[model samples]
Target: MSDLPPPPRLPVTFRPGHTRAILLTAGVVIFLVISGIAMLLEHLGPGSRLSFILTGALIFWALAQLARVKVVADESGVTVVNIAGKRRLAWAEIVRVNLRPGDPWVFLDLSDGTSLPALGIQPGIAKQRAIADARALRALAEAHSASSALPHEPRS
Candidate 1:
């Protein structure tokens, strides 16, 4: 038998910062507040259908951006949240995890021969120490896999 290590297990409980969601949400809030004040002042009367419609649209868009993203792990496998939503995959189901520093996002390498969409790990998040943070997460995933006893043997 060949000696090999198993894949890493994702963090059982993890939540990525929803920066896009938050920003969009804040914009909606501010717009509504201003609109309300304008209407109260009679500056924006009831006939201001355009302003009302615009405000409603912004609120809806914010809600859409507010996606619940999380990564969960267990003895069985790991679950990932992508554009399609959350999906649970076993360790064997996970082909690889390629977390390269590009486009300010983290992409996952899957087993079925598909690349998972990038999750904004560093979306608009610029800092002198962001590199360190990104590396740490990659290391954590590697360590988790190592600790989980996931096999690393080549298939023939």
Candidate 2:
């Protein structure tokens, strides 16, 4: 059998730029056309359209993870996130980096008694993204300080 964390159930691969697998491509295109017409008509402009606005907002949130979103896994534990804000936990401190299908975000339950979110691709685009992230996390944890912690350690 393979040694890796049994291979994340929903392994995903992330790409560069504003490339998001979760963003509903069809919906986005439709909204853009509608919003464009609304803007041309001066009906409070495209920004006033709720769907377009919401989609743009969600896209921005995903893109936020573009630069630093990375994943690393080793025998001990796995860490995934962008450097801007991150949660690093050793296996001892991790309950688990959940790999269930249909889960919203990659999660980390730290020894410090907190749950942090990882930058996981939306459901449709999880496999390649997860693999890429897992590789990065593995390398990082191996190179950096091993988190000296236990699974249920109390936070200071």
Candidate 3:
């Protein structure tokens, strides 16, 4: 009776497409502007120009990190790659998937007493897409966990 779409096939990846594109574009633009300004500043010494270019490169690297956020689901488990860290979880380890209103991204409640933030499915420029992604992920987790659980025991 649920209206949500079926879970995606294994080896699926969920990511904020628009956010990645925008971040990449912004990074390139910022790097170009900084390099251009450095080149145009004839009065600046060579060291200063190099510093400016290096700064631009560093900025681009940081932005690229954010753009790389994603969640990959395979037969083994799900891998969540955030800005600074990546964590892998077995399907049975995920107790629930949450993307409540006003949340920036999806959060996974683990069987352990911990909640993991999944930045890959963020409600940035594409809110609806993020919701769909979250739902799909949830469905995948539920399906996989249910099949893996022993029939004699209840799922926690």
User: Model 1: residues >4 Å from true position, as ranges?
Assistant: 1-11, 18-21, 24-28, 34-38, 41-54, 57-67, 118-120, 126-156
For residue 71, give model 1's deviation from the true position in Å: 2.6
Q: How far in Å is the alpha carbon of 23 misplaced in model 3?
A: 0.5
| Number of the candidate with higher lDDT, 2 or 3 | 3
Candidate structures ordered by TM-score, highest first: 3, 1, 2
For each candidate, give its TM-score against the true structure: 0.56, 0.40, 0.93
User: Model 2: number of clashes?
Assistant: 20
| Candidate 1 vs candidate 3, lDDT winner | 3
Instruction: List ranges where model 2 is wrong by over 4 Å.
Output: 1-32, 39-96, 121-123, 142-156
Local accuracy by lDDT, each model: 0.54, 0.49, 0.94
Taking the candidates one at a time, how many backbone clashes does each contain?
Answer: 7, 20, 0
Worst 10 residues of 3 by lDDT: 1-10
Instruction: Write down the worst ten-residue block by lDDT for model 1.
Output: 1-10
Q: Please list the residue runs of candidate 3 whose C-alpha ends up more than 4 Å from where it truly belongs after superposition.
A: 1-4, 152-156
Selected candidate, larger TM-score, 1 vs 3: 3
Error of 1 at 2 (Å): 18
